[model samples]
Target: MPPRAIICPHCGKIIAGDESACSWCGTARSHPWWRLLKPTRDTARTDWVAPALLAANVVFFAVSLILNFVSHSGSILTPGNNVLLLLGASGTIPIDRYGRIWSLVSANYLHGGVLHLLFNMLALRQIGPWVVREFGASRMFVIYTVGGVFGYWVSYVAGVPLTVGASASLCGLIGALLYFGKNRGGNYGNAVYREVSGWVMSIFIFGIIVPGVNNWGHGGGLVGGIAMGMLLGYNEKRKETPVHRALALACGVITVAVLLRALYGVFPG
Candidate 1:
């Protein structure tokens, strides 16, 4: 006879139903949080999530350039602050002056220059896959979106006037991978830790040398990423669940809505 199987709530691996503790992580099978999360159906594989994010960032940068050119403001390579603000660049200026707190989400897609977009996208391209592999695509998206928001929030609290870019969110991915490496604690884990640590050091140095870098956002993103990684767990400990998928979808929906609202502000009828 075949054994009955159930998923471990903590680690997210399937286990024999008869076991009292999850053999994978030793967590008790009977946890109550499932009742709190009545998420929608999520059976599909989530390969599209990273590509979609990359596309959004690139499209937003293109739009920013068009607006800057039309308005005769920032150069072709670098969009003006006005154009970025129109596209929902977040920080104290947008949040306080315009009362667009939602810009926190939109700003993740905006960038100051072509190089800014290129560097951030490259970083995302590298880290996004690693996160998807380790955390699952849904969890990866959730971490990325929330990390951007939290990082900007930190910068706002620190009184940064204006900011735009995906670096904060990229830092979040790095932080998550760092936590994964250290927590996993093996040859592969150590390798991930070392590589991510190099990123952290480079970012720190860049923030120090680059006068315009938002160090607050980078630091905040790192902190937020670590917190989310711990809270959400990972693939080895936990498989992607309906709740993770639902959260990612919710983040996507919110992002789209905010972008639309920003665009409406730009080209309102």
Candidate 2:
């Protein structure tokens, strides 16, 4: 006979005798004030999307870095425009004249410079896992990919000739967090709201200070993320459903098809 399972009070999920926390809600056996400070290690370990996205960005950056060096006097500081176009940089020209709309999705994985890659990856590392834990891997991917596409499309519509980076997706994640915080409505939720609000403020300041920054993408991505979070709902309020899984699968297929188009543009043979 199977052993009797203990039901978790937090999320109402069943668990084994030795389990110390609710895998679904992340409530520990012993409540600690600082425990709510960050997601526990177990929650972090259960997620895969955040790391996979990070690695994909890194790999794409390496490709662009090498190609940039080949054409730009051995410089990895900024990839040449040709390599960026080949890898899918979003712009009015690419999207309108050539009909390279796929760049909306592919552009999320491309970065401009080493520092650009580093900063975006660092932000992803910090916030991505939290989003994955809250929304599950599939929903998180939807937010990142769809939000990014929406963000880049805004930039395209605004006539930005060329833009590339993961900032839009990262902003989406932050926007999701903002939604989570505002809706949750408690000390923990309030804390999340306050922290993410600070991030939003800082991003605005950074955009104003930095030249060539695409505020349109950032704003659109944030709005997209909020919309996704509202539509999808969080893990606490609603469990991972088939709809989320299906959306994630659709995003994956679309991303692959877009990348293939980018490759064909590069080789054409």
Candidate 3:
């Protein structure tokens, strides 16, 4: 294999793969489990993370749409409750009746309507880069996945019988940005806070006016994001660690498995 180059953790200098340690900072080139995280697919690259998420959501939405159409019923824009449930919509119904706790993860990829998908994807596009820049890609995903799960779990406890959308995960991004801005406390941080605060207000206000909006999910995701941001620590506060990378890899694997299971449930032959 060809020798690879790595950025030194201590000094941000490139370390040749053959080197035992960084010449500039004298930090060891490899940690105990550094190699385990070295090749973590595209998640290591922050630029690809947002687009990958967009694609995954679109793919799931397409599947949901097709299944709804296959049944010869359901609005073109708004899928039926039955279809959403089959595709892993999370709530009291799926959790209580079906005992599909895994829906909490899968539901983040499903959508109820065209507008629901578009709005959420657009929001994700806008917020994803900022979170990645501030928190690093790994932590951004952790915030999204964990925040979404916590959001749906809260809504389930609140007696929401059925729900499907990416807004819950987007709220997690918004929450992380909010924390990054408020806690960082600088010109850049304040700017982020001001921008994210507008989003927060807009989200709650829209939720108030729009019927069927899951404000509980949004609120829960927001809180979950804040908590995750604190616990994970953004780039400004700390660099991405092997632990962060491992957590992201775990979330990615678990998510793929759950989504595949959701697909299988729709076609169990």
Candidate 4:
């Protein structure tokens, strides 16, 4: 005769006394026998866009350092007084003179010092993966590049001079995450939004207390990120599409082209 069956406590399923799991639903029978087994679940793995973005930032920094050395004998690149206006480092538009407006885009990859690079990259590592998972990689790239350009433009308009770094772009990523969390409208989402908002506020406060911190850039990047987030939406609104991949690729190409141009302009062999 067959053995009598018992139901699982967590998930209602019947199994024979000696069986470890339900034959119908695969629920583990939580008797002494099931207690001895390991737990497992089927979960989706996160995408690779965030790590790739971080790697790109690191590579850009390394290449910039090399170019700086070859160009001006300095270990890091700085805009020469002659080219400052052209390079968008001067923080002011030349009166009646035209230069590359695209420098706003290029400047996102440049950093002033080790601390600058460290802080920006750290922030990226912390917040970037979430953004990519929620919105996909391409949208995140758009938010980052456009947000950085907008932030730098604001600083320039405000008369802050000679700024360079990825902080503005990183700030944009934070902003996007904030918007995503808020728009989702749940305990989990609200909690995340609040936490990120606190981080943003703390950064602003620190900037106020510290000299040489560009609050304008930070504010502008945040605003840009929020705006882009509204336009692009969280993953709930759309699936990962080809548009995301294309935008990411475009941003990468633009970054590479800008670095090449900067190297050629500085070295001028």
Candidate 4: RMSD over Cα atoms?
Answer: 8.3
Local distance difference test, candidate 3: 0.85
Say which prediction, candidate 2 or candidate 3, comes out ahead on TM-score. Answer: 2
What does candidate 3's lDDT look like per residue over 1-269, in tens digits? 95688875433567897888767645566653223212222333545678889999999999988988898658877788899999899999999999999999999999988888998998888778768867888999999999999999999999999988888899998899899889876544666687789889998999899898999999999999999999999875799999999999999999999999999998997
Looking at model 4, residue 107 earns an lDDT score of 66
Enumerate residue pairs that collide in model 4: none
State the lDDT of candidate 1 residue by residue for 37-92, as single tens digits.
Answer: 22112312445666789999999899998999899998978999999999899999
The candidate that wins on lDDT is: 3
Clashing pairs in 1: 11-237, 11-238
* C-alpha local distance difference test of each model: 0.84, 0.84, 0.85, 0.68
Q: TM-score for all predictions?
A: 0.83, 0.87, 0.83, 0.72
Q: Candidate 3: misplaced stretches above 4 Å? A: 1-45
